[model samples]
Target: MSSTTTEVLQRKPRNVAVNTNPEHGLHLVESDVPEPGPKDCLVHVRATGICGSDVHFWKHGKIGDMIVVGENGLGHESAGIVIKTGSEVTRFKPDVVFFSTPPYDGTLRRYHVHPEAWLHALPDRLSYEEGSLLEPLSVALAGIDRSNLRLGSALVICGAGPIGLVTLLAAHAAGAAPIVITDMDENRLQVAKKLLPRVRTVKVAREDAAKDLGTRIIETLGTEAELVLECTGVESSIQAGIYATRFGGSVFVIGVGKDFQNIPFMHLSSKEIDLRFQYRYHDTYPKAINLVNEGLIDLKPLVTHRYKLDDGVDAFATASTPGARAIKVQILDD
Candidate 1:
């Protein structure tokens, strides 16, 4: 190995953000820099977007059956530079910016070892922050692909969170018209309006009936939505999406929620609305990267807040706080 590679390999005491337990929440812990396996690449993680799933794990201790056993690192949406590649690695070299997801310990750390196959090289034009956002953008693209969104197809996005907002951008770029986004928080709705000035925004209340909210969504669109991307994962929002979708329309569930949710099954059946669930993303990174590189979609506006790796706890707090109005909270190594 070269002297530079040896030096990077010897870097010590990496800072990692971990969810110790429900009581402790997220905090930084020092760990020895990990060495890459034969097919792994050691990455100098530059940016990691705090995902909603990470927050859910921190707040609730788990999502469904995936319990946080012991100390669990809590980030997945990440991009970084490959400082050292394993012996078998040939796809990437040192100093290449790439987006990656480490299967076990998360990427909310300065140094991460990721499998070579899992890494996708990011273009020079995109910042590490923008590259970190590809995971969520991939999700949005997957939802759009599943929706089969056509030009001028009326659509309803059930939540104005990061995923919902990215979906909004993807759908807009795909030529979906009269897109309406709903959120209980007026601040988030305002952000959505700012992201897409022509899009309609709706302020919803949890106490209000789902059917009523659905009616309001239809009214805002002036017609039943051909596609409803349910990003909230809330039972009420799912019900509202079901009610708002026209006959034969699709309701794609992209949000992760409780193990079981009560829904208006009969209504969904009667309306013949296709209820599809999104479990992360599948083979969308290339398309997502191309979209951003081609200027068809922009992910920069979604990063409303940024924090250094040492302030990981504060970053999670800002993301979890309702009043913070942070669309995407990113933790940076620099």
Candidate 2:
């Protein structure tokens, strides 16, 4: 818990995001903590979660147009206590937790400043680890919202990562029936089955997932899918979701894919299915907090490992490697 400054500029070095190159991984260097301007709150980060998107940036040095940003502060999913509140700040106390920030200097630090709009007060039942996951959770919930999940509806979600699992959790809470989840990773599928019992877990590769899931549901239930939530962003999986969906069904694209994949839209066009793209969340934090408060989504078991700020580089490495047996990797500063 020692903090000093490097004087990269004239200001404090503890707050500088020095990763300008996307190809290189992050390093824990010193930079200045800028003073909060009006309408901003200074957050003393306690925990920051390394996301898969961060891993892609670390390995490739770019995500679409948004690069890691030199010395790239590598974080976005985070939670922390309020240290300094700007003149216009409201809606949170000093000890509250919040999340879903895009890592400009990331939450892996002693102090950082952000707008009050993104901060959501953590309920007593939710931990900082859970709070830090609001971003991905929003991606899940947004899929549910856009797909119009309702009682007795059927949903097939591809890629049993955090977003897929959370989408399964939300679908169950929304009273969707026969929720189906698919992943090639047996371990991931097992974890999802144990953590979330509502979703029927299936092991299907991108090549066979569509016909596999579609055939099973089509034969057993005698009905096509009402909605498809594609959480993998893999090309074949995207086509799988599109093909498996019932006529006039909706597909919500929630994963962060930096590449383009060939999606055979013949089924979509012939079936007249609706395909919607869901990007980074907007106006979903409060509902996310409420969802956690109302017991709609349980995020406790989602976090598989924890590391410290100094080990952030390894955290990204861990997040980048799927075989590391990590679900949601978190970084703790307190």
Candidate 3:
């Protein structure tokens, strides 16, 4: 072993933010740094972004069938430095900054053992926080790819949350024009407007009817949208996106909601609208990296809050809090 790797292993204690249980909540627990397997690389986690799914698991202890029965680390959008590589690993070596998403035993720790195949080399131009953002950007890219968005395509994004905002950035870069984003939070809407000055914003109340909101979106955009990116899994938002889309257009559902939802099947059938769903993402990291590296998408504005690794509980609290107005809360090492 190299002296640098040995030094890292000896000096760094793995302080992992674990979801112990719904009752006990998130806690920082110390564990010994793990060794790399034959196909694994030991990463010194640098920055980890708090995701909505992370919050979901933190609060409910499960997302559908994926449950946290015992203590589980909770972060997927993460970037780090490769400190040591396994004997069989050849794709990467020590000191290479990389971004990755591990299943449940996540990257929110000082030290992490990850499969070398899953790690993407983050460019020097992108910060660790920006590298962490590649995970969500990948989701946005998947949604856009499914939508078949074209140049000058009219688009409506339901929910101006982090996913919606990233979708907007990706869609805009892809040449989708006259985009309108809807949100219940005015602050989030304002953030969206600030991101794209030409993009329209709509604020809808929780009690607003889907059809009525749909009509308002059409009026705001001056025409039915060619594509609707349903970033909010809310029933009303889904229905609104369906109503706002033009005949034969597509509505891509990117958000995770309840197990079942009531849909206006007759209306959907009548319009001949194509309904699609996003199942996480596939083969998107390279594309996402290129988009950022080329300066086509700016992810820096999205990170609204930052905290040290030890203050992870507080970071999660701020992220889950609505009034905090945090778009992306990241926990950094050191």
Name the best candidate (by TM-score). Answer: 3
**289 Cα displacement, candidate 3 (Å):** 0.6
lDDT digits (tens) for residues 60-93 of candidate 1: 7777767776677778888888887789999875
RMSD of each: 2.3, 4.3, 2.1
Q: Best lDDT goes to which candidate?
A: 3
Q: Please give the CA lDDT of all the candidate structures.
A: 0.85, 0.72, 0.86
Ranking by TM-score: 3, 1, 2
* Model 1, residue 57: C-alpha shift (Å): 0.4
lDDT rank order? 3, 1, 2
lDDT of candidate 3 over 37-99, digit per residue (tens): 998988888888998988887777777677777677788788888887899999764322333
lDDT digits (tens) for residues 1-334 of candidate 2: 1122223224443552313254475666776666778888777777777777667676777666665555656677778776667888765753333332234545556577878776777877777777887767877777888778889987788888878877877787888887778788999989888976656766775457555656764444345778888898877777767776888888888877746666667768899999888876677777887888787788888889898777776777777787898888888876
User: Quick one: how many clashes does candidate 3 have?
Assistant: 0
Q: Which ten residues in a row have the lowest lDDT in candidate 1?
A: 94-103
The worst-scoring run of ten residues by lDDT in candidate 2 lies at 1-10
